[model samples]
Target: MYASLVRSTVALAALCVAYPIQTQASDPAHESHHGKLGTVHFEVACNEAAQREFNLAMAYYHSFVMEQMKAPLERTLQADGSCGMAHWATALASLDNPFGWPGNVSAKTLADGAELMERARKTGLKTQRERDLVDALAVFFKDTEKLNHAARAKALEAALQDVAARYPDDSEATILYSLVLSANFNPADKQYGNQLKAAKQLEAVFAKEPDHPGVTHYLIHSYDYPPLAAHGLEAARRYSKIAPAAAHAQHMPSHIFTRVGAWAESVASNTASANADGGKTWNSPHAYDYMVYAYLQMGQDRAAHLVRDGALSNPTPPDHFAAAFSYASMPARLALERGDWAAAAKLPLTPAAGAYPWAKYPQAEANNAYARALGAAALRDAEGVSAELARLQALRDRATELKLGYWVEQIGIQTDVVRGFSAARSGDVKAGIAALQAAAAREDASEKHAVTPGPLLPAREVLAKVLLDSGDAAGALREFEAVLSKEPNRLRGMAGAALAAERRDDAAKARDYTGKIARQTARADGGVDGTQLARLSVTR
Candidate 1:
């Protein structure tokens, strides 16, 4: 009997070690110098809710709910007596950012996030963190009034201050506070205190939870935006090393790696993702998207191998249209990059819906990506791209009818750019510039309210080409100035600007721009004439 009891006891201990009731760490009290216990968790949730990756971040949030069952409700409340972390996790998933994935936030994402937060608050949240988060949320969700940047910042700051007061040493609260501040940083200030603060908080959190995938991924992303070269690249590399199989691990990191000019590291990260976790789990399209984009970055074919073609076509899950649409359009994008218009045919204007219910999803990332992809791929053939343009034109009409200014304006920018390109190709220089100007106008209108403006780059590039073709050197200069102001390294734009300057007899400036473009693109040796411009350049 004694021997049997000992064996059973050993088995129980092994099970506990394998998977604890919550986290393996022994801090049941979750103490800080001042706060009671879980106050910081609530604050963390609030901060996370405002992030661009809130959808992906929320998947890992469910673990908090499972952990809460092990501890008493009272024990979970912290310095301000906020409820456990789960409430805040759900809440965070619910709030929408003013600017969202790429540049703009959709009404649907915002509504969903707001509704989720409101549900928790109404449920009589049992802690101070919950109350505080709710109060902050209330100010954020004011009905379609002014999209007041200042007001939102103030509310988030107050929540952070309240949470940080008693839990100064709490890593979660600190990280959340820093993220809120960083998101609001204005580059014109010449001081990046908030960005630095977020970076510091991320450093501290990663030290404690080095293996925490979310912390690692987000830390790398935070680094990519800042100008810090060494530290940011190192962090990006570290993040790739840890979460080698994250859904977007493959190509997304390229944005970071290329930003730092770490092409080798970027190539390695993409290769690692392709070789190791190409299809780790079935139906996770992001995995395939990452793999394909990574492969393309290394100059490999962009086709994803599934036993059945198109089975994994839409890699984006329903809740994450931004990623899914990006991945879904990769095949078509690759075809265009390699100048294979036939191959790009798969991404039609009216793209066939994927296996997922993305049409019902928020942000319409898939819809817009598919629409834009059509225009991008068909740029070489005016007639071919026209069918796609018509589709977008119809969508814009619908959006206008529905009073969806954001979508109407956005799609209009795309249509006008395409029209400008088409007009230039058809020997209508005057009409082309007019269309380009229209596109530019829409772009300017879109920027005022957009957080992640998608079509801006393409529009500017197209407009610059038209201005140069029309012998409008000054206009071309203004267009290139706008693009270079934001992205100074625009390869084609620089070349076009140089061409324009050369025509206007600004020999030195022309030489400088031309040299930069030639070095950037080895094949940029030819001069720009109406005929060469029409044939070599894409209309859309």
Candidate 2:
């Protein structure tokens, strides 16, 4: 099945290259020219007007700009009500973030998707490829009430695989097949088999359709893991330029940038995304979170604070999970990353009214408790730490009750970190270290969830800090280096390693670590302190 899909994808690519398709109409007033959302050659069975609008909708669909795709798709249907593929595209867009947690998708949305699929079927798709595409997507909306999201996703993946096999020269089918594979990737699978398979197909498609937005965008997603991040650099750098008008495209590259610790590039990409039209709602908060993370990493705390404060003051941020996660995480990250334990401890448990639905997202709520617990531990406030620990436990229990699988585990991990820090602070150093090690091991075994850029503080980095404080310089150095191996150029890891080296009389190693920090933070707005630099002059 995979081989046939690859062959078909290659053939489609050759066709696209030989007969390049114009992505936009020459008429300035035409609604078909939404943005430079990349090229696609989906020849629909519709009138010329509907065809142009359908292509524009397909472009936005390829970039995962579902909201933007809707208007153009509606325009397509208005132009030619008989265009079945337009209905198929509408249903597909309704799926909305294939990897999003199922709970976020309401029953009404599922019912609507099913209705859209039925409408497409009623049109009697003119071409075999169009029929195949509709049939494959129909599986996801079929039996929506009977089958769970995972079950439907699995069925959809199988259906897409079959479509790709049958329509070998259908580039759209091949690209979508790759996307399903990526969406279905198991985070616990250390081998990254699904992601690599998806990337293999995408790379083939990319060779022929270098300007295709979906190819580049999905490729970055496939390689968003630490082990595979460098391989995605090409796609990461190209996607924004290819779909410069897409706010999501501008933001998407930052996923790779965050994974690879390219702080400056991440800051730039997210800044552009945040300044785009989508900045008023979910995308702005999302971009600001990444921007805050990058700014903090570069020792630019002043800039990071500006971004965080601006996002927080947005009177009416969207009540979406993505927005909530970013809004909750930005302040926590700022306080925790800067070692402002007091500030972290004082972080509001929920955003002000009209900001977001914090109650709906337990994971976002957990961020406040987690940061507070860690801060209390750092301050040796045993009572404060215990209270915050209880809050985290309660949040975890709530998440488990809600069947939020990923957030449940994440909260559990946070609980463990807090327990470890509290134990270490209370002089049960042995028990504390053991708890931290267990948490770090569990963290290292799993990949980060898509919703987060990373944990507020990585388990390993916390363990390393505890080790250094306990005078186990060698152990601390080992842990810090381990973190740096996976997250290259991370500021805290470098600083910790430098401190440990200095404590162990390894001046050369300390100097090496400090030099890298100096270069990375050369453009900083003053956040790296003397202690963080381990008393070594970064210049020397």
Candidate 3:
């Protein structure tokens, strides 16, 4: 395995050297500070100027930098008023965060997309390929008032699949089809049939167009899960280099990095992403959230704290769900990951309450409440836990009202953790253990949403700690090992396992776990002073 990884790394490095990170545009009209967003040959029956801008827009679209594509798309229309495909691309961009939950897209955005599609049709498509592309997008915007988002999404996916099937040589169609496949993937399907199918299509595109930004970007998304993350490493390594200017491209690689427990790589990827946006775009805070997770996993609490502080300090952070999520999560993660119960309990519900529409984002709001509940339970503050539980219940109710089934489930899991911990603190150890086991089972059964790096704290990790505290060393070790198997090299998991092994008098296993923690924290600032690892004595 080690040899294979090394060989893969070497080959990827060679590819990078061959392609280089930066590519200069041949046309002065195509020149912009956005850097090279990968090569795209989207054939259009427009003027040369429109064609250049349209290709650039397609490149941006492929990278999932939807906002950036707008300017180029507008430029394409400005260059040629009859550019029907440019209008089609504009309509597609309106479906922002295509992987997001149903109804997340605003009515205004949907109406705008419908208008753009009408404009495309009015302008007259020159080719069957162009018409097919426009028509596929039309299915998504068609009858938005009657068709729910999920129904439209499935229809769009089928439409795109048909388009790809008709045009076997069309890389753009194949890439877009793969993306829809990923977006419409059923998380409950443990077989991961859709994701696997998407990955296979993307892999074929990747072979033909190695530097195509969309192919690499969607490949990472397709293989984002634990079972498939290793297969995404090549794409992850190449994506940032392919589209260095795209903040999403810079950050997207960390999805695989986080899944594989490549903490240092995850930190670097998110850091570059954050710097690319400079805290102006939602991507900055999103990247910061990932940074906090990666830093915590590496035992770099001080760095994680700095990232949290920096993200929170952004005065005009984008007023969107992604930014709000990061604002709520970064501080909570910083407090909770280090087991700082007091800090976690004191964390404010919304850092900048008036900055964003907090009411619209019940899921984001639930993060602080969830953290506070866990912290209160850990601190043995039954009343505080109960108070936070009420807040979580209210948020869960709001999520249910919004028909956000995923957030409802997530909030339920948080509530369960708090109740279990509170029960244990109140002298019902058996009940607490049973509650935690149920929570862990539920958590294990489902996949986390793309918005989070992981849960604020994984349920199994909480269960492991509770078991350890209750003197079930063997049980604790088992749970910790389970967590590490799925989320390898987590500092807290390694520390918990080491301590549990120590308690069980398994010195060899204890030493092994401790050594992993020491290596992970070797470059950490101020060392692991307040972390669980502080309890273990690791001899170098």
Candidate 4:
């Protein structure tokens, strides 16, 4: 993750989704689409040969999305007289691919689609449908203004209205549409039964096209989404069968499976590729990150053992450079994430592995992760984290050079949280208070980009804990109460807050929140372990 983005509140409002081309089934008998194709049918080929979703969609699957879309697209075009231009809304959606694939073609497609959609609107599009996928894809992309279940539902419904009407039989649309709709439902708090409806919609898509890639993927996500709806093992089996081999695809699907209870199947593809076979491949570093997560979920000891081993064993393999990285990714990322002095002694090649924080993970997360990895070697490990700390500073400078406010505010947050933690832990009460004030300042500055919450909760907990340890019960009570006001169920935050309130002798506030914390903890399963709970109880 970029260092600058580490503290950002991303405008996750309208950016994640982008439509792409139709692809056919990728699993048809090999003769139909395989092996140095003497007769390569563009539709059924699934190799990672090109960057365009249109290019890969056909190859990855054994069926054709174009065929499913043919009639309605034609009718839509004829209805508006733009040679089915408005029909390409989804294809135009594909233009947003940031990675360089589809090359100039996507650009041309976007320009052309933009003009045509405009012409169609002015020329009186038959239904005025979406007026070129809505002024621009961004308008329909995310509904930032709306926060509740009703708003999310409406925004999602409105986004897919065109696909649902124009291509009723397109299972891809059905699956994708439902996936968007389902994401809004918080399974933990279903002020509406919309989450259940979303699940049924996903089930409907699966019923219609059990093998459809997006449907299968969305089905897994549906099961994982709020409501923790039950998913059949058969569904997992089917997903395992048709899953994409690409690192990108594997990353998401594996996590979805993990979330939905697919266990062993979760990281199968990633671990295989990460284990490597002395050839170039495309299992990405990001994929490696997700693989570690999946492995941890599956209770695999030393989740990233294979990835680090493969990197240490081979310098280069095949596919992309990442496929065969000969040396372990920079000695830096390793020391940050791993805890072995033995691994550190070997030292990976220079220009080590590092990533931009997801704007959500910010530098604070990376720094915290690095700090925790210190374990018994905290003193010696300080040097490596310092180097990373410098890199984080450099990243902020770069973001500043580019005039990226989001990154600046985000990096500031990272600096604040880290500074706050250090100050509070070092027994610098006034300095900790000052650092926390800065932390809140940075977080507030990055509000638009604050889609995912940052370290605000933990930072407050540190301050509150410091106050409690110092016997300033009144100050501790205020800090913890403020934490709860900001984050209703921040595990550690709640725990620290509850304890602080009790210490201040505020019986009612302390008792009410203690019960709330207990209930929230039960719902959170063991994410907040017993040791953590032990810190909060005023009672046995």
- Winner on TM-score between 1 and 2 is 2
Using TM-score, give the best candidate's number.
3
Per-residue CA lDDT of model 3 for 329-441, tens digit only, reads: 98898878778888999998656676668888899999999999988897889889989999999999998887777779989998998899789867899999999999988
Q: Using Cα atoms with residue i matched to residue i, what is each candidate's TM-score against the true structure?
A: 0.57, 0.90, 0.91, 0.47
Quality of model 4 by C-alpha lDDT: 0.41
The C-alpha local distance difference test score for the whole of candidate 1 amounts to 0.46
lDDT of 2 at 228: 96
Report the error of model 1 at residue 363, Å: 6.7
Q: How many clashing pairs per prediction, in order?
A: 13, 1, 0, 38
Residue 73 in model 2: lDDT? 78
Cα displacement (angstroms), candidate 4, residue 197, comes to: 7.6
On residues 294-338, what C-alpha lDDT tens digit does candidate 4 reach at each position? Answer: 332222223234444433343432223222221222233334222
Candidate 2 has its poorest 10 consecutive residues by lDDT at 13-22
Q: Sort all candidates by TM-score, best to worst.
A: 3, 2, 1, 4
Error of 4 at 479 (Å): 14
- Residue 118 error for model 3, in Å? 1.2
Better of 1 and 4 by lDDT: 1
Off by over 4 Å in 3: 1-35, 527-540
